[model samples]
Target chain A: MRNLYLFFRKHYFIFLFLLLEVVSLIFFFRHNKFQNAVMYDWTSAISGRVNNTYNSIAEYLYLRRTNFILGEENAKLHARMPQAIYLADTQIYIRNDTIMQSEYRFINAKVISNTTNRRNNYMMINKGIMHGIEPHMGIIAGDKIVGQVVSVSRHFSWIMSVLHKEVKISAKFLKNNQLVSVEWHGGDYQIGVVKEIPKHLIVSAGDSIITSGNSEIFPEGILVGTIKQVKEHQDENFNTATICFLTDFNGLGYIEVVLDMFKEEKTNLKASFQEL
Target chain B: MTNLVSRNIVRFFFLILFQVLILNHINLGGYTNPYIYVYFILLLPFATPRWLLLILAFIMGLSIDLFSNTPGLNAAATVLMAFFRPFVIRAVSNIPEEELGIQPSMRILGFKWFLSYATILVLIHNFALFYLEIFRFAEFFQTLLRVILSAVFTLGLILLSELMFYGRSKK
Candidate 1:
């Protein structure tokens, strides 16, 4: 009607704003999960490539510090390898050949680009599909779980760093079998919050934290970090503690990507349960 | 005409690139994620059509949401901001409609008036953004804290940017 047109003309901006908001909400609700359409995927790929190019230029800036960490880690691994062989019949799991079959293999790669100062920090590594790196694989620096792989390209992959709010690393007490999760609180890059640790456990400062190995992505017994502080809730049933990570993600350069050979089979089996 | 259109085009591309590539990565602790993109909404020409301004704001914020995986929250907040900007400007500056051809800047509105305008709209944008992202009022206090902190940080950054980038155009 003429009146309807007149009303619309008078308040066109309001109607348009409302209409766009409704469309956005509809798209958001229908997808539920954030949709990574083909365009997004392509952009990520292009961005990763661009990031890798910049990483090469930045690598020379940290050669000295990176070398020191690598030397320390190599020495630690060499010392640990002998003790494991003496204790167990076979120290590690291997697919083939004479190489010691360790449950986890640490493939060294350099970080090309990284962001530690974001709500969701991500790091891009120099090695990727060509180097046998794949998505969902665990990443480590020193003895700590740095993060897990999220996306991969031919020559690069991005890590969802533990500094990110979205990252939830499985952790457990080395002294006891109790399991918990460590999540970043977006407060500090050096610290993360350990959640769901039952209050019944005798926890104290300097308590050791290790990977729970509950996720298919990471093997059991990997080092996470240690509890730096604990705030026990008098009435609440669980203890909220703060953990200090061993590896400085800001100092990231050379890292070891862990490839779990059983990953594909295990993921498929897990998917079967959801399908049923 | 061509020069004006080309200059606007170049500014738009640079603003978006600066937002996503550089400012997006800077997290100055707490819930304060610096949103320099709102500069676009704040700096839009006064003569720009209200509906078109709202649409452009929607696109700018939606593009950020798409890149950052934040769903509809940014778009919703930005459109809300665009909806309220004209009123905020009129209330603060009392510039007659005929003389509104000038763009928003310290020169046209004066430092005191422009600062008030920017602060108010930044608060509105951050309020809608942080609350919508949280999607619930259960943590009303925490959400309020985040909104206030982000607004302050964003205001500081916007003023710093104005000093650095627009310092020469002192009116």
Candidate 2:
């Protein structure tokens, strides 16, 4: 027993080092899978407050640019307003219709903190559980896809940006309706790669890629990027294309969290079907 | 001794804030991220107990990870760097017994000694960090490029900060 104590005393530092390293590695591997919500809430709450304070001070530096973008978006929205549209068929009376109901609700949130340099980048928004933001919901800037919410605190949420390697967005070519997956491969924040394109398809530069609405997260027709180049993959079957993201991730200021109204119902229906 | 402890405490928070708030935003070319926060680990007093050193390094790293939303990458790298720090110091310089408790700095140690020490530790930290971040050998060359570039930038910032302190102390 004394010999064992001496051994421990002599090699305690090594044991401690090993212990810490193992703990950290566990945290690393278990981060995305089965995230400890309480720990995340505690940490994010503190970081959220700090980032919120810092963002409030730094917001002034980009006011002009933000205003310009907002103005452009406002003009586009204004053009689509009923007041701006000329009615050619005045005989047909326009009435409130019960057939169509709102499918997606948009909640405006300011980005508190964002990073693009890392392989797995994340963005923090100034809205969370209290503000109706939840995990697995989509986020967008204007009509461009930004990311999906991964975790939420009381008043803050973390987003796994499209720049993340594991984030594969279901997208389709706007011209042909051909489906493809958009993924970031850990370099160049402004660019992503489109995969699963059959080699026979005629793909060209500048082809627009938009959300396919195959998943519950994003609605259809939201812009993702424009194709920059297409390269033949090692497999003889599919070709991959590089795309330029429309949303400038580095200068993201305001974003909207997409709350699909029927998401729960759809998921529940799918679950019931799978049970059979 | 109390004064030294308090100063280090102040430096610990100051470095974390400076790193997360300012340095993180400077994503030059989307490749070179200067992790000057590792300087805090480098500047700890030489006589700090091995267990305490490891704990402090872990806490510092975890704090940075929390802010950045990277759960464990920084913590692992910083702890490893801290574990290697004593051996690195012994290899780089022959310190007299009386100078055992002094902090490592360019002003106390010559610029050459400080540079090599900082370079090795920063490289080790960045090497572990960037590789573990990508978690693959597929992009080995690209990740290596990022590691070297980031390490150079981090070393430059550490030396500059040390020089700034050196100039103030001289006055």
Candidate 3:
């Protein structure tokens, strides 16, 4: 007994270090999808409260710049209004032309806290479960696609920004409607990559990329970004295109989360295929 | 004592806020996010109990990781870094009898030695972090590239912080 006591006294710090490390490892290894759901659900409340306070301060600092961006976006929309009317006038003459169509809905909320430099960047918004925000809901800022809601509390939610590697959205060429998966390469916040565009399909610089609406998270035809560069892979059949994101995630302060009514049915159907 | 506690609390909150808001947002082009919050861990008063130091490091990392939602990644990195810190300090600094009781800082260890010690320890911390995050060897080269690039950026941020916090005075 005496020897055991002395031994513990001498190596108390070592024992403590080992203990904590063991606890951390256990936590890491034991975590599964179910545990993740519970953990995020618990932390979501704490984060909502903490982020609410931090976001208010951040909101104050970005007011001028946000207003400026909003003004510019508003002007661009107004400029397009005249052309939209011209097209509508042209469409009135032709009853069955479905080529010209537009589908978009914008929900505005202040960005409380946003991190772009991290390997997994996340943005918090003031809207939450209480405000119709839910997990997997698509998010947008102004005219550009940002990310999707990962978790939500009563009054706040977290966005898995496009800057993160975990973000993969179905995107396609606006002209040909060929679907490709857009994912960030963890290099630049402003640039992401669109994969699996077959080489035979014609691709060019400055092609517009839009959401494919395959996932019910986002409505089809949401503007993602424009393809800045297209590189033909040496051996692969697919060409990779670099996308220049329209929204500056670094300066983000406001965002809108899009909630589709059919998300549950669509997600369930998609998930059922994977389970088999 | 309460005054000191309150002052530290304010500083702690401000540091974390700045870390997540401003520093975490500065991408610098690639897989590099300057972990300035480790400065909080580095600046803890010398002679702080080993257990207390580890707990503080864990909490600091947990707070950031929770916000970032990378599971236990940051907490694991910070705890490992804290565990190794005292050993690193002892290995690098041959403390004189008079300076034996002092904790490490620019004043106690001098700039060159302090920086060397800090760089080595932070590199270890970041390497462990990158490896764990990848947690796979399939894309070894890509992960290695991320580690090197992130280390350089983190080193620059650490230097900038040292300059800002301690200025030119050796003490």
Candidate 4:
């Protein structure tokens, strides 16, 4: 017991220093910004209250700077959007200049409502008669034709999306001009069937289908989809081709509405011919 | 003993008030921030009990840390100073005669002796405090500069206060 006392007295300061240092280190790392914040919550009430008051004062002082910095960051993000001044004309070129047109004017509109699950699903856009939108306008999103405008209101329009059972758009094989009509199978949004392409055309999976422009609703060569599976029947002369829809109908955000001014004249001529 | 306790009690309030209210706000354009609260730890009675010194240092540091919201920084630094005070006093004073209760000041220990003693300890304390605050040695030179400037300012404040409190020439 005397020896233990001697040893402790001799090294008392060193032991105390180390112990207190460890305590300080515990506090240091516990409240460190890089560490998990929940570790060092054991603080005195008086100090905590004092810190709170100090922090409140500091917070009030820097609030204006914080707001300014946040506003600047937000403005930088907003500037990245396609600006009205940059895309000044109806003939707008987006990233990679994939779309450039004078024959067919493109009006960019936001998709307000959309669905891809039902037998005959439809989509609604935030454009209508007020924005020169009309029925039969082809809606395309980044390389693929999405749908056509079936009804128009004063400020909004509904689209008969290609996922609909009755949708039959004029599509042709990109490899060869083997014309086909695309219709949704109602089971999966990804798969759509192409009709009228002959089995003798040597159709296979991975073949790209594009717009034939036979309907004049969409321009020639607008992307339709890629062939996923070739369903051939011995009795039928035509091949039943399943193609993956290039446009993700479920993720549609903004789409371009194609307005062909010459469509009115073509419709008028067809109407007159029918009258005869 | 009574004089020592009462003096320390008065010094405690004054040092904290000076540190938190006045010195903490003085930002000299990112060049210097004089920490005057450390003066209390420096002037502690030289032959004071080891445990008493550490506890006093801890409380002084804790008070400042509470006000600033840096809970451990000042406490750690002050405790470090308390731990080293005896060794530093022994080294500079070179006199083991008064090992009990000699309050360090320019009046007690001549100007030159006190100058060297305070300068070294203050530098070490500031160095520990600043380095712990950043905890990164990658900016070693940058933090070193801040520590040096802050130490010099603190040292100056300590001397100025001493001159005011303890007369120029001790009778």
Best-performing candidate as measured by DockQ: 2
Q: Point to the candidate with the largest TM-score.
A: 2
Q: By the DockQ metric, which is better: model 2 or model 3?
A: 2
TM-score of the second chain, each candidate in turn, equals 0.89, 0.94, 0.85, 0.91
What local distance difference test score does each model get?
0.75, 0.90, 0.73, 0.74
TM-score of chain A of each: 0.77, 0.95, 0.77, 0.63
Q: What tens-digit string does per-residue lDDT give for candidate 1 at A1-276?
A: 999999999999889989988876765455323223444456556666656665666567777876887788778878777554565545354447655545567788877666665455677787877898877889987667889887666666677888865678888989996999988865467788898989788889898888888887677877778899998898888888999887777778777898787677777998999999
Ranking under TM-score, best-scoring first?
A: 2, 1, 3, 4
Q: Sort candidate 1 into its docking category.
A: acceptable
Predicted candidate 4 versus true structure: per-residue lDDT over A23-60, tens digit per residue: 77666565424121222223323433443355456556
True contacts kept of each: 0.33, 0.76, 0.44, 0.27
| Residue A271, candidate 1: alpha-carbon lDDT | 92
Give the top-scoring candidate (lDDT).
2
Q: Kindly report the docking quality category of candidate 4.
A: incorrect
Better of 3 and 4 by DockQ: 3
Candidate 3 on B53-152: residue-level lDDT in tens?
A: 8888777777777666665677788888888988877788777535743345665567787787778778877887777765667557766777677767
Q: Runs in model 4 with CA error above 4 Å?
A: A32-276, B99-101, B168-171
The CAPRI class of candidate 2 is high
Clashes of 3: 1
Could you tell me every candidate's TM-score relative to the true structure? Answer: 0.80, 0.96, 0.79, 0.48
**lDDT tens digits, residue span A1-276, model 3:** 999999998998888777766766665544333232656677766766777777677677778987898898888888877555566356455545365433334568988777765556777788776677767778977667888877776667777888775678898889989999898866567888889989888888889999998877778887888899888899887888898877788888767778675556667988999999
Residues B1-171 of candidate 1: C-alpha lDDT, one tens digit per residue:
465456556766677777766666566553356777888888877777898898888888777764554546678888888999988987887777666544677765567877999999998998888766556565578667767777888888788877676665532
Preferred candidate (TM-score higher): 3 or 4: 3
